[model samples]
Target chain A: MTDAVERIVNLALHLAHAAKPVGHESIRRDVFGYPKDQDEAAYLRMFERDKDELRAAGFVIEANEAGLYSLDSAATFVSDVGLSATEIAAVRAAGTAALSDPSFPFAPELRLALAKLASRFEPLEVPAASRQADESPSDQAENAAALELATRASKRVEFVYTNSIGRTAAHTVEPYGLFLRDGRWYMVGRDIAHDEPRVYTVARMADLMVSGARPKSPDFSRPAGFDVSAFIRLPFQYGDQEFSAALRFDQSAAWRAKGLASGLGVLRSEGDETVWSVPARDDAALLRWVVENGPGISVDAPTELADRLVSTMRKAATLHG
Target chain B: MAKTPASERARRLLAVIARLESGSEIPLVDLAAELDASPTELASDLETLSLCGVAPFTPDEMIDVFVVDGMVEVYSPLPALDRPVRLSMTEARALAAALQGAGFSADDSLVQRLEAATAREFDAAQAERIVRAASGQHAKGVYGSLAAAAGAHRVVTIDYESAGGAGTSREIEPHVLFAERGAWYVAAHCRLAGAERTFRVDRIRSAQENGESFTVDAADAAPRTATPSGDLPTARVRFDAAGDFSARDWPGARLVSEHPAESGDGDIAGPKAVLGPLEIEIPYAGTDWIARRVVARGGAVEVLSPPDVRAAVVAVAESYSG
Candidate 1:
């Protein structure tokens, strides 16, 4: 491992410093720690490994059949993120808020990256604001790391995943991006088996491995104009269809209900109860909310939903009985 | 998993070079410590520096490395190496999502800063989609003040409405303000209850910061202990496979056991166990909280014990008519 790292470092420097594209013969002669003379196989293996590592690190090391290597001119390090002092503070504060959530997997990398960026400016006071919500804990460190790696490398990943329905299966996907929605991390990618795009909840995944065993070779390319959000279809979409559902929250749970309904649908107050009308598409979601809030909330409209709720309640009552 | 020394060293070497290119003379020890390396590794890095530079490889063109006494001076003057690197699109996207998740609107100052700081042209639509809140985005002023109070450790009187629709005034020493499921909450010491509490910030009607300050101990502010007093009364329930994920959302909820799938009943009228059963224990302040939940979920869950909880659930379920 040490030798591999050292070779990559040396090769990167050699390519970076070259006035012109450095040929393989020149690299072998000038760069130290190359295979001792007459071991062509070992030298080629080491060279390929170094090239891959450097490319993965964001160095655009170009090579051809003739073994000429050059760093992409535009790929050199630049000092200007163009952030003002206030911008740095904002980024720092955002980072701090993210770190406060114990389940965030990328905290270490975030801290190191932010420190480097902030070192350019005088330390700024982190704006005191509310920390981010700690959602239900999800142990997804390995998945998170794998997604990060594949996303950066533009490579594919293979993983064994279990869906909510309890079906576990293996899949290979070309990762487009990773996103967070509703406090959950999701990976948007193209499923190889299905030959179409899919969104995966990171928490539901297990045994993730990034593809592209060889360096500088990507397993797949993201489709043109691929939108991560466009491909994602959440299983439950309230009020997305023809069902217009109205729920009434009595005074007892009105305040908390309003908080829950903050920006979702039209809410109005009538006497002590708050009446909300939403296009109820999923029964389970609303049911969960109503059940959690106790008797203070009721489905007043869409008799079908109300009937379902009552029947569901009756089923639950039998369990306790 | 632990990072391999090779990968760790590669990361540090890249970071060190990038830092030095910012025209800063970094102290050898400070740089080494930041990289989690020893002075010996720093020397090795300097030795490696001798081999790097752009074309012609002349002394002047190469990165000059000097460790005089304790300071490491590096001069490359490489245009490629001089500037602060742009935020990678992934990093920018993640930051944007987190900032938005914390309830910052597109017009918030921090959001504006983020837009300004991002040097590359990010897809505005993509970024918007990533950060858009599904619901319960906070009112900016209320969120900001509470956050400030918590950071400053100020005791403040707040008019808060409880889940049961009761409003009360209490002096709370704000320790931490966080969001959970799009709702903002402040974990604090409530003087009225004389116990630690987590108050939903949005439900707080008004806040009057007291000039007085207080100290916060880590033990006192532990999140598990921050449950508001009213959510009392511990109850245990078993949820079939389909409901296991959501059941864990309850405060202080834990999985106690898992039961094999129960076969169907001979009678079609009776409830069928849809999925394998999972037994979970939860500490809840209100029986109504559990009762309503079980009633709503229908045959999916069952309150295993605590006759009072069972009765309450049965009552609520019987009250609802289709």
Candidate 2:
């Protein structure tokens, strides 16, 4: 098998560097990997499979009408697109950091990508970034596998999910997309039994398995206009009913609203305070979020929410008093 | 040696050919580091590549890659494969993920620029939409600037919004940039504080390089623990079982003890099984931050000791209640 890898690589190099299309006899005689004891038919079969693998790896191997093979340099090779120093630094910094992070799902591909771009610039002195806090190696592997299957293979997956309340159940999901939030991976998919979209934390999944029905073809199609970003909501946006809510950041803390809001809702400035109009699905959670992020932030609308805040705070103060 | 998958080795071999085609001699150690392989393994791969050649099988037609005197040297131009191959679907996705993890958006200029080097048939937009790593919109530009500054060891002045809601300007020497919990942070020596502090990249409202550079001291570059130091004041707080709390929420907090729910304990009512209230001792440098966390949980959490912290929590809760 190792020799097969070498043989395939040797065949690719032979064809790519050939001055003109060379026939099977020439390849068999010259390329080092082809087994000398193999008969002509078996040798040809191996050659055809090698070529297909190379093509699948993004190489363009053209077979001329005369049955000779040659490399299409224009299609096979990447042309130089001038990248600014900053762009190179950006890629190198992020790419290097990601490569060292085991939790990052794309480490192997990222390593190859960085290798391709290695000659572009001198390596930056960026240190390796830390992995997500509290992530175990096993969880990282399973999460990466689940994400790979969900996004690239478009496969359905089955897992026993333990929800926040510790209730465990088996679920078969046609995973549509995946996103990273707060260093945790979440898969948004259609639940087979409920026939509705739901988000499941990858860490809470157990005995996860991707459908083996068709390895090459996707098991299900993502609904049209289904964007995973829409599913990644704030801490306060997780209930059945959603309503408009307004929170105000005092003048002193106004600068923090944009970054804290994370582009979720519209933020406007009136006088000195910054008012953010965002969607709220859980009033208790919203109040908690306000208190959690507050010193200068407070609820500004929906009299009921404001009253709840007041009552909750009164209870908190009395508890401490 | 761990067995290298045939497909992965094949891809790596192509990249090796492309890397060596430039005709410059690269040290085997350096090349192995770049390719994420060990030197011995790379040397073996080079030996394997040396036997590959075109139709003639003559010395001139054979691949001329070799490792000599600790350096990889290529004498013959590999021709068609001399240039890098197009970015495969996986490689393209990796690039997008890396950039997005660094806070760049799918439509970021760097993404668009790199997209040109991808295979024409690859659907980058679709791939970007499928896997999102973007956590913050404003952090992208800030991250780029800080990265370059850290690489150059330059002093940068930044407008930072602290966790307590106060905004201040600090000129610091950037040492290392790291990510934890989906946010990027830079550990640097703050001239104002005369100590090394980690600042979240997203909280930096603006950054500008001050042109002056400083050398990083060995101590300054040492890894800083996320936990608060022992000298900081500790606050004892009781978290009701109804509230979802974990040790991770407080970096330096330790669980003191657990008090089982009494028959009439009203705080323990919830659908989930309630174990009781948790007594956690949390260390803090300032009262405001811890107060906000306690008040944010409504009455589920109570500050149990250190009268100042309790007063701070009461003041914060009362400020909103009034």
Candidate 3:
């Protein structure tokens, strides 16, 4: 492993720093330390293993049929997140805070990412803000790792997903990107079955298997211009069954309620009370939010949702009171 | 720092090479410190780079390096290697996500510059769609002022809407600004509360930098990996398998054990005998937060200790029909 590792590192560095792509003969003659000649079969096996290891190490090694290899050094090394000094400090602080939250699946990765950026910039002296301190860390390690591998390899993945409805089913997806939203991790990918972009919450996924795990990795590549943001949905934007729901907030909570309604739905203020007609993709979550705000918020439209909230509240009142 | 990953180290070395080739004769010690690597490891990396070059193996064609008295000089043998490293797709996405989440808008020139530098085209519209400013335009302006104050270590008076829905004015020493779950918050030392507090930025109605400055204790300023505040009351709860999913990310919460809830103990208010398999303990300052969560989970979880928490849950649940 050490020999393979060292040779591959030198080989990659050579290619990365080389004036041009080095052919197979030049790599064997220059990169390989042993001066003595070797059998072609053994050399091929070693070279193959070296290539795999390099790829696993996150190097994009491009090759031609003629065996000319070049390192995709540009893409392999830097990220153009383009954060300013202050923004970088903010990110580092957040990364530190995330590291504090033990449940964050990407803590180590986040640190390394931040460190890489820190190398180019100064480290922030003070801590920023921390989050997920009061939240449960998801038990989605397997799924998270699988999605990471798939994204790194630019390969498809197969997994068993237990959707919100609790129906566990198998899915094959072309992993595009991994995103953190609302304290949860989600994979934005193309669902091969649906032939459309889909967002799969990592916590809901199980038995994740990267397509690259197979011996003959597919020649599959992500579509050009694939953006993870397209698949990410906000809290209120989640759920397929979207409908208009209205809520009225009394003067007491009008300020916050008005803020929530901005850029989301129709809003009107009457004297002191504020009314909002919002597009709700998840009625239960929407209703729960209203109920949690207590007496100030009242459901006005979607009588069914209002009824459910009222009944749920009534049941709680009956049981707890 | 954890044991340095070889790949990451290699990339850093490459970055050093690029930086060196940019005609800056940086001292080896400073370079090592900048890359967060030991001087020895960096020296070794230089040794490795010395052996690598273009196809032909010749001294002149190889990367040349001179390390003398802890200073370093480098000359790249390969002209093609002089270009600055571009950000990888994943790296770009990670930064874009984090920065946008931190409130950098698509229209922000820095963000646009990053987009231009990205190895792959990241659609600004799509990126904006993923995470938008949680607060409105007015609140966003307020957030900017508060964040600036925090960065400058200034004391600011803010008209804030408290969690209980009351509006009040407070003077706080701005420490740090952070975003979580789409909401922006500033953790600061509140002169009014006489304690360090986390204030939601959106809830801040107005903010004015008093031009008064306050120095944060170094200990308090350092990035905290754990909750910075002092200890609080602890609550114990049992969660069913289904409940575990939702309970996992609960803040200040830890899974105490995975043992099934045993039958009734000597205590009159004991386990219901049919409790779930997972038991979690969370330290909290108050009951309102945990109570709301328990109510949300319905019957999947139950508070096992602190009668106050159970009572709080009951009170909140009862308010629905009140």
Top candidate by DockQ:
2
Candidate 3, residues B102-154, lDDT tens digits: the string is: 55556655567655445444555564543332222235346556655666677
What docking grade applies to model 3? acceptable
Top lDDT prediction, candidate number = 2
Off by over 4 Å in 2: A18-30, A62-75, A133-137, A249-259, A266-275, A291-297, A307-321, B21-30, B53-65, B68-80, B217-234, B240-244, B261-277, B283-291, B298-322
Q: Can you write out model 2's per-residue Cα lDDT over A1-321, one digit (the tens) per residue?
A: 337767887777777777789888888887777788999899999889888878866687787899988887777777876776656766777877676666787777777777877755566666546455344534854575566656567788888999987899999998888887866788888999999999888878888888888689998888998788888888889899999999999987687788778768999999988999999999888988887766678888887898889998999999999
As for TM-score, the candidate ahead, 2 or 3, is: 2
Compute the interface RMSD for each candidate structure. 8.0, 3.5, 7.5
What does the lDDT come to for candidate 2? 0.76
lDDT of each: 0.61, 0.76, 0.61
DockQ pick, better of 2 and 3: 2
Q: Assess the local accuracy of residue A133 in candidate 1 as a C-alpha lDDT between 0 and 100.
A: 29
The docking category that best describes candidate 2 is: medium
Which lDDT tens digits does candidate 1 get at residues A33-116?
576574878777778877765554445667667768887645444343555443454455456656565545555454444544
Model 2 CA lDDT for position A245? 97
Worst 10 residues of 1 chain B by lDDT: B264-273
lDDT of model 2 at position B132: 79
Name the weakest run of 10 consecutive residues (lDDT summed) in model 3 chain B.
B264-273
